[model samples]
Target: MSRRQSELEGRLDDMLSRIAMETQEIKELEQQLTDGQILANEVLQRDLEGIISGLQEYLRGLRDQARRSQQQVDSLQAENQSLQLHLEDSQRHCRQLEDRARTHTQDMSVQQEELSVLRTEAHALRDRQVESSRQQEELEVELQQLREELARQVTLGQLERGALLAAVDKEKQSTEIRECQLQATIDTLQDEKSSLQQITLRLQAQLDQTRTQYTETRDHLDQTRLQLDRFTAAMLDPQEVQSGPDDLDEDKYRYHYYNFIFQQDLAPAQTARSTKTWFDVHAITVLDWPANSPDLNPTENLWGILKRKMRGTRPNNKEELTASIKEIWASITPRQCHVASRQ
Candidate 1:
């Protein structure tokens, strides 16, 4: 009985020890699983944070793009309105010019008709003078024959002689009166010719002036049309306006500069004085700019930066140039914008 009891106690200790070993193994496995799960959760959290940050940045970019689109639309609408008004005015002026041209043309036609009539009448008067002179020569020869006949027939009655002389005198007086009337007609025709020539010259001058005005108006209208066409094309596809790298380069530089100028309305009074003719021609309003300002121009600095950025890239086409420019612009940091603003 004592031997059996001791054997039973030893078996229980062995079983207990085996159970403790199994329990220790299970704890170790649970600790490894927990550690793996924690590590996975941390990695997932980091990935989600990155995704959220990227989405937020994309959303901001979209908002900014939308804002810029709206501003461009507003500016285009305003410019279109102004162009419409200018077109209407131009059309109205064209109509007035047409009316004046028509008036001048009609006046010229009337003057031409008067001139033609005067020329015909002057020619008729010259023909009549030639016929009158021939008739006068014939009458003078007949009078001389009558005087010789009278001298040869002196034995005849004195009354017959007296009658012949009286008839000759009467005929001479009639010829003199007719000559004076013809001379008066010729002088009158000469006066009309001179007046008509003066009128013709004056009308020609007016016609030339009208032609010049019409040409100028047409040119102005053509310029306006071209401007509207360019604006429409730009509205449809902004890239269409960029013909080449040089154009894009200049335009990009001007874009930043003009934006800065417009945002602060910089140098308003100075611009009015410097570009008076240009402003007056365009009829643009000059807003109030800060006074007595230093010329802190930022475009030159931006140009230098842009040139440096574009040093390595040589675009072969307009599209390539445009893409390169866009890429460079996107790469420009906020610090650059801040620096430009400060300047």
Candidate 2:
């Protein structure tokens, strides 16, 4: 009995020691589980799996030992009533070991759940890395295309600028040429303007001379017309009255003092200063004269004869009228002039 008791004590002590070691290992694993998955290599994963499997195996062995101890307690109770107390103590110790084994199993299960969650998170990280890599490739392609398009735009702009510069140069040359031509034209036109001014000055001088000549000619014609009017008046009217003595004989041809009688109508109304036509300013007697002297005047009688002949004949134009006047004046008889002259 002492030997068996000593052996039982030794076994309990060893199981307790093993259980404490297993708990310490589980606490270490729990602490390492969260951070270990990020940098853990395949070798570390293998070592962890070996450790977990070994703990599971150790727990299984503990359960089997507990079941064997229960069997021993049951057999001892049936075979020896005196060993029942000792066997009961051994059974209690076995139950405690079984409870410890169950606790270890529960702790192992929790650690496995934590490892599984860590693996899922690692898979999610790998998927994000692949998606990010694909996005980076797409961005690089878009950036390359934009750079090429920008290069093409820059080249096209350079070509257009060159063309515009060339066009500007051509326009500048054309403008300079046109300006020179316009300046030459202006100078030529100024010369022509000076020539025209000289010609206009000559024409103005000619026009002034013509106006002067026309004024002199018009004055000469006016003087000639005045002389003709004076001659006609002098011929139609006697300037003086000639009368013989108071009782002068009709048959006598000579008289002592002769008086000249003038006609009233053809007498000069204004004063005249001339040697040959000197006369008094006394007016002629108008009350004793006839209203018309057409019968007494020879020139009046000639005009009557001419007008009588031409009155019946209507001349169509000025030339015909002038010809008719010439014919009537030539046909005048000497008897008509003698009949018109009376005392």
Could you estimate the TM-score for every candidate?
0.23, 0.28
User: lDDT by residue for model 1 over 1-343, one digit each (tens)?
Assistant: 3354456556655755665575566556556677777577557556755765675566566556656666877899999999999999999999999999999999999999999999999999999999999999999999999999988787576768888999999999999999999999999999999999999999999999999999999999977765655565455447857763334323223232222322234546645665766454433454555766533446555665678889999999999999998898778886885676566
How do the residues 74-188 of candidate 2 rate in per-residue lDDT, one tens digit apiece? Answer: 8787778757778899999999999999999999999999999999999999999999999999999999999999999999999999999999999999999999999999999
Model 2 TM-score relative to the real fold: 0.28
What value of lDDT does candidate 2 attain over all alpha carbons?
Answer: 0.70
The most accurate candidate by TM-score is 2
